[model samples]
Target: MSIQKEDIDHLLNLDKIKADEKNAHIVIDPDQCAACQAKPCLIVCPALLYTLDETGALNFDYAGCLECGTCRTICPHLKKWEYPRHTFGIYYRQG
Candidate 1:
């Protein structure tokens, strides 16, 4: 899949707005993430939403998330971690 420059810019702008909105956010369980030695969420996130901190814990940015389910699939250590609420994640203009 290829994205045009304009589309990329738009997505970036949207992400900024999404992040700024406090109501819509990524909810993560640090305890659930802490024991994850594999840290698959760090690599599987297409938008790099799942980032690591100085302590090696997962930090997430819901706005930049594409909601592709990659993190959900790659994470073998956790049972469930909630993402942005419905209708609060990325929205592509085109399929």
Candidate 2:
């Protein structure tokens, strides 16, 4: 069966993210992001974690990360990508 937008939204709503304020699982280089012409991470992230501020600087909020690693695969400027330590990350619920 083909999945629709509502289906996807429903699936997303079933998941939860518990952020670890002291440690982040992903890191990106701002300097590299600034020089890059194509910012695929802005569009490709399922969690919508990547964003651009009014000053044109890239901002990433890891709190809601799906741990899907799409940003790591898409962003050339990404400095580090790893699973969140221990008990902090996405919790998928049965839908």
Candidate 3:
């Protein structure tokens, strides 16, 4: 279940995002979220996109999210957040 170069390459190919590329289209809303007390997003996020700050506030690392939708589904509150840019977020392979 570890990541590899091909996974990264595949995502880049699909999203057309080159290495060291900038995905300005990627965005996340910390304030919009209710910051689920359980914070299941942290556990379910395969890419560890959801994390907490020193102050315990939600810190969203969009780049690491696999766009798995686990967070969206697990959240009792759907903040109606948008998906990562077409070529943005984490990429993966079966191997």
Candidate 4:
């Protein structure tokens, strides 16, 4: 069985998790990212942050993140993925 958008949306609706939206701890260098053909971050991100515009520019919103390092793990262009320095950045409700 497949988990539909509504299923994921329902899960998100149930989340009592808090996030620090001001500071986007995970930073991506656009220059380094430009060369990448396969952008796994857009697909792997649970929060639906990484996106592409009509002009093909990378649009990322690191708000309400799970901080699971899914983006970091998937990006081949990444030399080193940096997690949030602050401890209170991501608060997981269920997990």
Candidate 5:
């Protein structure tokens, strides 16, 4: 099924979403990741925070991140991708 804003809200509604808006916590080096042909992180992220821009460049939005660390493990470009520090990222109670 296609995910809509309401669907996302419904899913996270029951769970507590503690956002650390002060910091992005997760950072991506598009220059380095650009070399990666197979971007599994784009699909592995449950929150679907990773997306492609109109120019086909990698785009990432951490606003609705679940901080599941899926991107960290799936991405081959380890030189840039990383999870937030302790208690510095989005926390989903059960989302």
Candidate 6:
């Protein structure tokens, strides 16, 4: 079956993310990130949470994370990785 943009959008809309305000499940080492030339996290994150600021510094928002562990697997600069606390993080609406 051919997947249209509308079909993808509809699938995305079915997922819900509830962020943990006080806790972030993923942590990247700035020192490591600064030294790294190839920042794969920028492209590998399905949630599109990773970005580079004007100063070329890496920035990430834990909110709306898909909890997919893509960053942890792809990022060598990652300092810490864990699941969010109970009752926080993504809630899949799809069956």
Question: Per-residue CA lDDT of candidate 3, range 1-95, in tens?
Answer: 97654675555454432221454223445654544567787677655656678988877655544556777777755545456555454454343
Q: Model 1, range 35-65, lDDT digits (tens) per residue?
A: 7787777666656667778977678766676
Of the pair 5 and 6, which is ahead by lDDT?
6
Candidate 3 colliding pairs = 15-87
**Leading candidate by TM-score:** 2
lDDT of each: 0.63, 0.81, 0.56, 0.69, 0.71, 0.81
lDDT of 6: 0.81
Model 2 error, position 43 (Å): 1.0
Evaluate residue 26 in candidate 4 and report its C-alpha lDDT on the 0 to 100 scale: 70
- Clashing residue pairs, backbone N/CA/C < 3 A, model 2: none
Ranking by lDDT: 2, 6, 5, 4, 1, 3
As a TM-score, model 1 comes out at 0.59
* Model 5 per-residue lDDT tens digits across residues 30-84: 8876877888877787877788889778888776778677888877565544566
- When summed lDDT is taken over every stretch of 10 residues in candidate 2, the lowest stretch is 2-11
- The digit string of per-residue lDDT tens for model 2 on 1-95 reads 85454665666897887888999889888889888878888778776677899998888878778888788777766788899988999899887
Pairs in clash, predicted candidate 6 = none
Where does model 5 exceed 4 Å of error? 1-6, 78-88, 91-95
Q: In model 5, how large is the Cα lDDT of residue 32?
A: 70
As for TM-score, the candidate ahead, 2 or 6, is 2
Better of 3 and 4 by lDDT: 4
State residue 93's C-alpha deviation in candidate 3, in Å. 4.8
How many angstroms is residue 18 displaced in model 1 relative to the true structure, after the best TM-score fit? 4.4
How many residue pairs clash in all the candidates, one count each? Answer: 0, 0, 1, 0, 0, 0
**Candidates arranged by TM-score, highest first:** 2, 6, 5, 4, 1, 3
Tell me the deviation in Å of residue 52 in model 5.
0.4
Question: Considering TM-score, which of the candidate structures 1 and 2 is the better prediction for this target?
Answer: 2
> Relative to the unseen true structure, what is the Cα RMSD of model 3?
6.2
